[model samples]
Target: MLGPAERAWCVVVPHQPRGARMARHRLSTELVGTIRPGLLADVVAVLAELVGNSVRHAAPLPGEVIRVAWRHRLDGDHDIVQVRVTDGGGGAVPRLRPTDLDSLDGRGLHIVAALATRWGSDRDGLGQSVWAEFRAPAARLPGPDGDDPAPNDLLATR
Candidate 1:
């Protein structure tokens, strides 16, 4: 289960060509050094796909904007990152499309699926939201010399 640090970041950006870039930059800034580097990259990539799809296919929300939200928390021994993008309802439901070599597009959700531990979409009264969740490896802290070392007792000539 998610721990107490449930506060999430939600940003509203112009639902236009640049929205995806804005979302990626903001999310990367917010999450840097907090999660694993590979996990951070995956999160940013998923955010880009979600925001890009919204801009390309969906309508803007009530004020010509879309909502992007993300949160990360330590759950037990590992970290979990959740990202969501909400847009005015219009486009067809998102799914992993089968793509071949000649396909120029339709691989966004596939990437999301492959990277995220789990993902899905939902609709509310105002709009639709697509979300993905990633489980990061257990946090690793440095030892006294700033490097992880085998426990002293285990290293004692057993």
Candidate 2:
């Protein structure tokens, strides 16, 4: 677990399908010892969807690159993991689109919505950044009674 201060990890890769895979690898490696298995899986999936969207929708301009970053911080009792993927500008704004059962695509945002606690996207001067936040399961600690402390109690400590 990180201290009270925020800690971040990031990578920049060429805008391509392979770049998303590379970003996933880097994210997994960086978070190996820090994040729990289940939460790690969710985080990786979110990264993939965001990066894949950048590759498929926001084609990079000359000299542009896709950037993926994750930051960890303690918010009260919860450990908050925030991820952002930025790509070159000029793509359509990301939104949830209804898909038919016969459709083979268009589920990326759906998956992200299901997994992330909160998510949104914004346009910047250079490009758009899609961001998501997930609250990691709280760490178990012995309470005064020698049993696990309730979640509310943990927050009070903060």
Best by TM-score: 1
Output the number of the lDDT-best candidate: 1
> Global lDDT of each model?
0.81, 0.80
Q: Candidate 1 residues 1-158, lDDT tens each?
A: 43354437899988987998999999988877566688889999999999999988899998999999998766655677899999996668888889998999988899999999999999998699999999866445454567753322111212
Each candidate structure's TM-score, on Cα atoms with residue i matched to residue i, is 0.84, 0.81
- Put down candidate 2 lDDT per residue, 52-113, tens digits, no spaces: 89888886735767988899765666767899998875457889999999999999999999
Q: List the residue pairs that clash in candidate 1.
A: none
Candidate 1 lDDT for residue 119: 97
Please list the residue runs of candidate 2 whose C-alpha ends up more than 4 Å from where it truly belongs after superposition: 1-5, 61-64, 139-158
